[model samples]
Target: MYSQQVIDHFNNPRNQGRMENPDGVGKVGNPVCGDVMYIYIKVKDDVIQDISWETMGCAAAIATSSMISELAKGKTLDEAEKITRGDVADALQGLPSVKMHCSNLAADGLRKAIEDYRNRRGMA
Candidate 1:
């Protein structure tokens, strides 16, 4: 069973799209679940100015992607990096045990994006 928050996010995902000239991007997939996600971010002055995602996944994956976008926006790079899988799951009011990996992928994708951003700037 999905939580109300999860249903809301899945029904109306936030920031779900390709970004224009993203400062960084991350791609992740679960071969077993066939859930793939591409996270994109635009940074300004070491802060996340904007965030978005394109995901091929189920309701849990989609909701996690949506939640991470909301969590990352307006956060400084360090703050965004601190967002964890538990944070995404908590924000969504928790996910089913079997679907927990969806949150893990979401967090990993965002972290990867930040890493990519830092790497591009020689800050990694």
Candidate 2:
């Protein structure tokens, strides 16, 4: 079963799309579930000015991706990088035990995006 927030996000996910000329992009996949997620971010002054995602996954994956974008947008790179799987799950009100890894993918994707940005900017 999914939480209300999860259902809400799954049904009407936020920031669900791709970005053109993104400062960073991250892609993650779960072979076990065949779930794939791509996260795009635009950074400005070390802050996440915009964020979006495209996910081919279950309800939990979609919800977690959507939640990660919301949580990361407008946050500084360090702040966004600090967002954990628990943070994504908590934002969604919690995910099913079996689907918890979806949250990990979401968080990892975002962190990877930030890392990409940093690396590209010679900050890494």
Candidate 3:
């Protein structure tokens, strides 16, 4: 089962698709569950000006992806780096235990993307 917001997000995820000239990009997946997620970010002056994601998973995955994108937008690299799986899960309210990995996946995607950005810009 899923929350109303999760269902809504799953059906109409915000910040879906991709970003052109993204400052950073991350791709991660859980092979056991076959859930894959990718995150794209566009940053300026160390601030995340835009974010987007693409995921191939269940409702929880979709919800987490959408929520992460929203949370990452307007955040600085340092701010976004501090975001954790608990933050993603709390943002979505709650998720099925089996689907908890989706939240972690989202967080990992964001973190990796930010790290990629930092490495590219010599900020890491």
Candidate 4:
């Protein structure tokens, strides 16, 4: 069963869209669950100015993706990079044991986006 936070996010996912001319984009998929997540970010002065995502998976995946955007937006790259899968799961009041991997994808997607931004800017 899903928590209320999970249900809320799943029913009304936030940042569920694509970004135009994003500074970075990250896409990741879980073959086991056939879940795919795409995260886009825009940075200004090393801070995440905006963030969004597109996900194809179960409710947990959608909820996790939504939560990651909220957690990362307005955060500096270093701060956002520190957001872990446990943090995301906690933010959602915890996900089902079987669905925990969804959180990993969400966190990984965000980190990947930040890395992409850094690499594009020659910072990595």
Candidate 5:
């Protein structure tokens, strides 16, 4: 079961596409569930000027990706690093117990992307 916010986000998700040439990118998934999330970020001056995602999963995955994009945008690397699955779930109000993993995956995607950026920039 999905929440209203989750349905709304799934029906019309924000930042739902790919970036042409992103500064960083991350991919995560659960093969068993066929859930995959990819996050792209465009950073400037250690700040996430833009963020986007593309996912193949259920409503919760879509919602989490949208919320993660919203949370990461305009945030500094440090700020983005603090984003957690709980924050994503709370942003969507909440998710079904079974779908909680989707939120976790979204956070993983974003965090991995940030780490990729840091590594590329020799910050890691």
Candidate 6:
């Protein structure tokens, strides 16, 4: 069963789109489930000024992606990179055990985006 927050996010995902020019972009997928997620971020002064996502998966995947955007936006790259699967799951009031991998993808996508941004900017 899905949590109310999960249902809400799946039904009305936040920041669900691509950016015209993203400072960073991360793409992650689960071959086992055929779920793919793209997370885009725009940075300004070392902070995530904007964030968005495109997810192709079940309700849990979509909801996790949406929740991650909320968690990462306005956060510094270092801070955002630290967001974990537990963070997303906790934010959503916990996902079904079988669907927990969805949270890992969401968190990894955000961290990967931050890594991409740092790589592009030549920041260590």
Q: Write out the backbone clash pairs for model 3.
A: none
Model 1 vs. true fold: TM: 0.95
Candidate ranking under lDDT, highest first, comes to 1, 4, 2, 6, 5, 3
List TM-score per model, in order.
0.95, 0.95, 0.93, 0.95, 0.94, 0.95
lDDT of 1 by residue, 43-124 (tens): 9999999999999988999999999999999999999999999999999999999889654489999999999999999998
- Kindly list the per-residue Cα lDDT of model 6 for residues 31-55, writing each as its tens digit: 6767889999999999999999999
TM-score of 4: 0.95
Q: Candidate 6, after superposition: displacement of residue 32 in Å?
A: 5.5
Q: Output the lDDT of residue 85, model 1.
A: 93
Better of 2 and 3 by TM-score: 2
Candidate 4 lDDT over residue span 24-74, tens digit each = 998888667679999999999999999999999888889999999999999
Give the worst 10-residue stretch by lDDT in candidate 5: 98-107
Across 1-124, the per-residue lDDT of candidate 2 in tens digits comes to 8999999999999999989999999989965767999999999999999999999888888899999999998999999999999989988888889888644589999999988998899989
Poorest lDDT segment (10 consecutive residues) of candidate 6: 96-105
State the number of backbone clashes in model 3: 0
Which tens-of-lDDT digit does each residue in 12-103 have in candidate 3?
A: 89999978889999888966777889999999999999999989888888899999999989999899989988888888787888778644
Which pairs, if any, clash in model 4? none
The residue ranges of model 1 lying beyond 4 angstroms of the native Cα positions read none
lDDT of 6: 0.90
lDDT of each: 0.92, 0.90, 0.87, 0.92, 0.88, 0.90
Prediction-by-prediction clash tally: 0, 0, 0, 0, 0, 0
- Candidate 4 regions exceeding 4 Å error are none
Question: How large is the C-alpha RMSD of every model relative to the true structure?
Answer: 1.2, 1.3, 1.4, 1.2, 1.2, 1.3
Tell how far residue 33 is off in model 1, in angstroms: 3.0
